[model samples]
Target: MKRLRLAAPLAAAVVALLPGTAQADVTYPDPQPITGQEIIHDPTVIRLKNGGYVSYSTGGVIGARTSKDRVHWDDAGNAFAEPPEWWYEYNDTGDPWAPDISYRDGRYWLYYAVSSWGTNHSAIGVATSRTGLPGTWTDQGKVFTSETTDTWNAIDPAVIRADGRLWMAFGSYWTGIRMVELNPRTGKAAEDATVHHLATRPDAPYAVEGPEIVKHGRYYYLFASYDACCSGVNSTYKIKVGRSTDIEGPYVDSTGKPLLEGGGDLVLEGHGRYIGTGGQSVFEDRGKDWLAYHYYDAEDDGTPKLGLNRLHWTKTGWPEVF
Candidate 1:
């Protein structure tokens, strides 16, 4: 079984500790023993048709990294040779951040965010690629946007298809997480698509974002990053989750408290040398689920390293990160 491949690492660690199940966590995902170009932020990873893994992230024209076995990573260069001219309208640097990659139809579609720091004036853009490799993508333009006057900020997109319809989940500190339906034909928001709120921190600056949805059994689960990020060791970032039966959700944690009310069961948090575990996305490989995020390595002077863990579920249906 694909899950069995991770058992060796769990045995080597000599103990089992799961997020939200334990008060003190000393072990986590690092046993993949990831190597090469480990510094990354806001990563969205995907397994290619040819069976290699590629991840697109924030920085340098949508920075990229690829691994043949999901362990030994190599810097694969930026997704675009140059930023599309449209990007400069959102930021002077034409920098894009937090890309989500998915394979649809016979091609790959990439969605990313362009925005300035400390502002809600942001836009999420789309690009398409034939090979799902860096540099093969052609810019396709904006999928969604948020204005300063609006309550939700558009960034950090994660897409999921449910019941034959495509949907995008996105948002940042302004009002937390929100969702919109996408036109599967063009990868854009559906005509007159209504924006829906998913989760929020319930306070000013809400502090929740980076949402990814995965369907399992009878429900759709929402996984998200909470708290401050990008501060290295000082970062208070953590990963949390809630689940709902409907694709458009009023998600709730195990306690039955709604996510819109600042409730989520803990999934991963800073433990031992792994600090600030956030900027997350999840992907399925070999019939198993893997949670992917970036963490600040205390031993490495707080350099961000990729966080990969085999995802498990409790008998009650809650997520447990190993």
Candidate 2:
């Protein structure tokens, strides 16, 4: 098994000491500013068993944050618990991006990717926590690598456990979205497995990426961010979706069109001053699904920041955000 070494016990102990200093109450997905400084991108929030929320994101030395209210946040700071020793071996300049959290088997598991924009040399790393908070994390290191320097870019990983099987959806740029099965116990890709391409657009210069899968009403819905992102005020990103009866999909949009044929129902796009909104993670709180994403804060001179909106499912089973 390939592994990446994270920092030692010092960092983890420091983070563990944090939750003792403050306490807040968890609430619904309210529209509140969680991070007051730096650009927060690729936000993934999970509800811990202890009744708090933990959020992880991209591009900073800090890997996770803790919040009692899901609005007010405190930086747990660098839960990688180790230096870049392992990640540096893979790509020295790449930053850890878009961490997805899942609680299973009496632990909190974080699956994340490391890569720079437009590069295929990306790898997915994992860390586990006995307690879902910051300090208890045990970095299990690299579980899989794209290693596909020529054909496809592998980044933006999201894992979903459905029908007693663990499935991973990931890809970007070169060949679009792809899925493969993983060994549930180890959270590693199955050996000799083939990746199935779920979405692609060879004709469009802009690509489909950031694959996020969620099961709703006997259908597996794959939500992907389309086109370019991270251009600040000039971004061109949009949210699109396709659904299929099977977890491994031939996902189709509402018109009975396959996603491979460029069929997607547009969910959210830039409005007025807000430019290029996409890269979404949907979460259900109190029976209502909320869309969590980052967009340029148009009012603040177009500063890129995280935003939240309540997701409404239409009568036809499509999703929309108000």
Estimate every model's Cα lDDT from 0 to 1: 0.87, 0.71
TM-score of the candidate numbered 1? 0.92
Q: Following a full C-alpha superposition, what root-mean-square deviation does model 2 have from the true structure?
A: 12.9
What does candidate 2 score on TM? 0.84
Collision count of model 1: 0
Candidate 1 residue-wise lDDT, 45-147, digit = tens:
9999999999999989999999999988999999999999999999999999899999989999999999999998999999999899999999999999999
How many clashes does each candidate structure show, in the order listed? Answer: 0, 3
Query: Which residue runs of candidate 1 sit more than 4 Å off their true CA positions?
Result: 1-31
Clashing pairs in 1: none
Per-residue lDDT tens digits for candidate 2, residues 1-322, read: 0001111222210112236664322112223346544356777777777788777777564367677776776777755655455777556754687777778888888888877656677877888888767667677877667765545566778889999999888877776888878889899886676788888875745388888898878888999988888878888887788899999889988777888777787766676566677767877776777777778767777776666666666566676554
TM-score each candidate.
0.92, 0.84
Clashes of 2: 3
Residue-level error in angstroms, candidate 1, position 297: 1.4
Evaluated against the true structure, the overall lDDT of model 1 is 0.87
